[model samples]
Target: MGKFWGKFLRSTAVICLLIIFAVNYRFEMKKTIDRFKKQSDENYYAMEKDVSAVNELLNILETSGNMYYKKNSNIGNHNFDFRYRSKDDIYVSTDDSHRLIAGVNKISSNWAVKKELDMSEILSESYKNISKVMPDIAYMYYASKEGFVNIYPEISKDSYPFLRNIYRLDFVKKELFGKGNKKEEGVSWSDVYKDPLGDELLITAGAPIYDSNTLKGMITLSLKSNFFIKKIDNNLITDFFIVDQKGNVISQMSHGNEEVTSFYDRLPKKLYDKRYKFSDMKPCDIEKIGKYYVYYEQCNSAPWRVYYVTDMVKLNAELLRGNVVFISIWLISLVFLYGASRRKAVVEDSQQTIEKLQVMLRKSDREVEKDFLTGAYNRKGFTKIASSELDRMRRYDLDACVIMMDIDHFKKFNDTYGHACGDFVLKSFVRTVVKNVRLSDIVGRWGGEEFLVLLPETDYKGALLAAEKIRKMVEREVFYYHKQSLKITVTLGVATLNVRKTLEKSVEEADEAMYSGKETGRNRVVGYQDIMSKDIKWKK
Candidate 1:
């Protein structure tokens, strides 16, 4: 009888030990999987940030270029070789009386150079015609080292000479020889190249002067490419580079010394081969390149690929490590509880219940944070995250920007089309916004037709430029439904958190600027400073 009792007790003890070991093993495996999942999630978020920064940077570059172009179109013609002394000697002679012969001549000698002139002659003709037509004659000159010389009329030569020389003329070095002004050379021109004649030039608009396919020289109607580098160097944080189809490095914001191989050099070989299907947003780990969160969009129309790359591991490792620590603590606590629990049945049941509850809570949290339609952050989620960011900025004394956007005439579209169309429009809008916004920037559906974006470590000017880009992208996207095409436009209001007294103030300022955009024109971007200067009252 004593031996039977002892054998039964030993069998029970062995069974219990086996059960405990199995449960603990399963739990540890789950923890490992969960750890992987958590890492993946953190990586995903970091990738998002990287992508957003790229998009915003591209947008800023594009918008600034556009603005510069609009401001000074005839930038190349600002500086002309005008014989100031031989003003009286210059006679408007032509093949016919109706035509005029305008050529350069030496002031000291009577020897007149009949069309021994550069491309500026054509511009001078145009200016002459304009002066004949208009009462007031203001002219500017943009001298080129080679190719067509540019001429502008009705411009303040003193003020915009440098701009004209740098942007429009494509002059490598410009020397302004004036009485009072010291000879100014090597001055980096602004991206916003403004001609005295009110023409704007874009640095990106590289309109080359080709002499029958042989690259003699290039003509730019905007700032020099070097100017772009200097500006980017001054403002942008992330490393930026412009690459051509042959993988030749055209320009770089930083990290230019790195070899320029194929665009594939930046991406995995598999991704390079399958370029068409490659995701614009992906986190890739490179050995010496470091962990880069890369986003690239091929310019099918242009001979270029616009890409943004950042060191992902270095930027977000701290956050990821912190998250891992928290998860490790939770797992350790669970393991301790499992080891200490004596009642096997009760313990298993309790562990299962806790796990289920934790899953439920996480799911609930995700649902609240994510947009139902697009799986992006909702307004509330954006606010929460933005608040956290604001706190961080305040603590760190960092820069940040916010952009407010609204669909143009969305109400009219809803009225003209059905509610179904409206929903489609909303979905389309969200898609475009998501596609354009930087992964670092927070984009959310603020309300029905309104969206908000938070750009960390950016200034008001940059935010305004970013908003303009989003507006342009939304405008460009073709929305098709049932063989019907619908064009969409948006108005954006930009404000910088770096400038505002408080986060609330920034939001309010941005909101007001957005309303101003609505009032001024439906499709435009209004800066917060402009709104405040107007003293218009509004709320966020």
Candidate 2:
């Protein structure tokens, strides 16, 4: 009877110990999960904040560029004297040539000879008023039916002889134009030259002048690209570049190497042919190059792309460090709990609990870095992965590319079909994009309606093919909603990252190329280097 009682007592004690161990293990697991959830929430909020701030900066720069161009256009229309340069040698109408008598005895009644009247003087006088109002005016020129006339005092005859020929009102030929234009108009930006001044690159703002119900000539406002670049206050540490549709670097603001001109010119020919349909900003990391966040916005009614990029490593490292420290504290708390727990069964349970907690913590970390919707690395996740990939590529001298894609008219679809349908489209897009890419490729949801695909061991040619395949797949895939079939298309930009290039620059170049695609049309891929090779001409 005493033996039976001892056995019962021992069994009861063991059961109690097991129960206690289970309870403690459960509690610790719950605590760890809670801590992870809280940390993840905090990290997500911080990432959102960072994205908003950077987006705001980009918005400001975009707005400033628009405003500057608008204001300049308005000023040009209101202040400048519009005149047509004649192709034929004809005397200016005496009535039209009459001078205002402010201090003179009488108004000049003689017909102004093309050569007799000081063309430079008339232009200088007309531009003097403009200079007073717009101090940023480096130079202005008026092309009439007769010849080229320099309106600004700063311009010299020796520096711009071509201005005379360009002002001689002639019909635009199709052969000299880019792929898009069949016929060019009189008042267009197409006739503008970059290397005209012989010293620095210049962008011309041209407007055709009308007289007597006829196209007389055109007026051009030549300003250095530097003037526009100066307006953007360099806030982020990333380099800024303004690229034309052809991928030519119009202007760049950077602290790095300067001898990289014609960089985009080196892109494969196949990529250049289809570069005018892509448009989106994408974030990515390059191993030794660092982290990059990029966005592209097109100028209204222009073929230009304003590409903005920032170094993400420097920007987010501080914030990520703070989160890491917070995580460390939670880990230390878990260790303390483990040490305090006692009992062999309890210890075993606690070990299992710790293992589960560790797994949860690791998963939480992944979630924080990954995009919830697509399961691809989020912007943060891309940054981490890209850095590593870039390092691997560089160390082994491998080729790789980053492709960015955005759905065309995505907002309109969302507005018309509802958010649920929009989500379906996004998910469908991710599936299609992933399927079209190689297993070695990494695809991520870059942000709202945008995605980035990292192609390792691929050159520009390979990247372009992949981009084209994905573009076609997305275009062909149909999304169903309430028995209605809907099709969606996307624009893609591809840029290769090589040993000499930084990841930020590569992404920016790709973004610029993508926007060029958007400007031309949708459902196409654009290679950064390819577009830069040819001079892209825009029709009025």
Candidate 3:
């Protein structure tokens, strides 16, 4: 009986120790999790703050650079006055130079060239002042509408032949003189181009010169790729670079004799393997690769993305260091407590699995059907749903209508406000339309800034009313981005399905009507019937 009493006492002591271990283990685990969560939030906020600061700096610089041209290019008379003269009056003719000259002259007014304004001293002094302010500016120059270039801190003539007739290049033809470009007031940012002279990547920022309504010439500033990298390379937690909307790297720091322009070859495989529709990426979304965390933020004034990459292995190392003691204690406790907790853990696991399954089922439809950018229907999903509804309507001989709409001056908006604002505008547009339309109506993204609304069981008049409501809502909506308010408008075309028209043909007719509205004036809705009365040649 004494032996049995001793065994009972020892068992009681062991059970007491187990309970103590479990409580301590749970407390430590909670503390560790809370600590890490706090650290993670701090780091995330720090990163976001840094990104915003850098983005703001870049925006200010670009804005100032553009304003420099607008203010300086209106020097004197409307004449293309180039004061800097070559040391030797040596002239070389080439097909490229001739084409460039012709391109520049094509945009110039009929006014004769005047030698009256000698702004050489002004140009040289302005360059000196600008250099003091912006040391990264490698070169500043002015080009005449006749293809003559006056470069500050002049170099030998043999070094830059292309500068002599810059208008011949596609950059001049497309960016500066392209259709729908407001040449005089607009600034153009060149893609990363290989510099023939230095064999390095370079980007040119230019603004057109204007006298009243005529294109006189342009002022340009060139910066090396390294110059941009230096501006934001001070951070240790993340490394970032600029990329265009198409995911092509614009300017990045070169490494160890690697060619800076070999973006597709040298960039992360993930960037090249899949296209980033950027529209789908949220501001706080962190994409995880094998051992890296990728974050991107859009520039407020450019159609470019600033991508930040952090090494997850390095991040985890910092996280784990703080939790070592807790982890060890937890592991030891787990061995002793497993048998006691096994049944309870099994029940919890089952419950968690069922809950996860239910959540997955609910999210699957949204994942499959929604557009990544605007949360609208993707093209394929929309087409399928719309076609099915159209088929059912046809069988019942019910009336249905569709509208095609596009944001007016969207490209201009992007150029002026930056791609980030463009994204904001798109989301706002979708939200406005969705709010005004019936819940039964379907809105889908047809393409960039283009949307299609499927109005089931609605007539042509109803569709027009819906379209007009959307148009007015967009115009009246105050779009706020980065503390600035912007106004935008849309043009919509309405068409109703008839027994004679297929569902696809009805969509096409609506698209055509939208184009007609665009041709006449934007921010208005046009009905297909209105255009059908006229002999209109629709663009293929």
Question: Which structure among the candidates has the greatest TM-score?
Answer: 3
lDDT of 2 by residue, 88-154 (tens): 3222211222121010112123343222123323333455665555454455554444333434444
Candidate 3 residue-wise lDDT, 1-540, digit = tens: 997887787677668766876776566444433333333333333433433443443344334434444555443353232222244333322322111111222223333332202232234346666666556666666565554555554544466554534555556566445634344454566666665445565666666654445554556666666655544432223455566554556665444222444444545676545435334554434565555565644443344555556564545554444345444554455544434543312113445544643543342122134565687885656888887886887788887888999999999878998887888889988999899899999998876788999998998888888899998898999988877988889999999975567878988999999999999988899999878766555643
lDDT for 422 (candidate 2): 83
In candidate 1, what are the lDDT values of residues 132-188, reduced to their tens digit?
542222332333323223334322324322332333332333322111232221112
Off by over 4 Å in 2: 1-124, 154-187, 190-193, 255-291, 318-540
Q: All candidates' TM-scores?
A: 0.32, 0.35, 0.47
- Clash count for each candidate, listed in order shown: 29, 21, 2
How close to the true structure is residue 54 of candidate 2, measured as C-alpha lDDT? 29
User: Where is model 1 poorest over a 10-residue stretch in terms of lDDT?
Assistant: 107-116
For candidate 3, what is the TM-score? 0.47
Per-model CA lDDT versus the true structure: 0.50, 0.53, 0.60
Ten contiguous residues with the weakest lDDT in model 3: 95-104
Best-to-worst TM-score order: 3, 2, 1
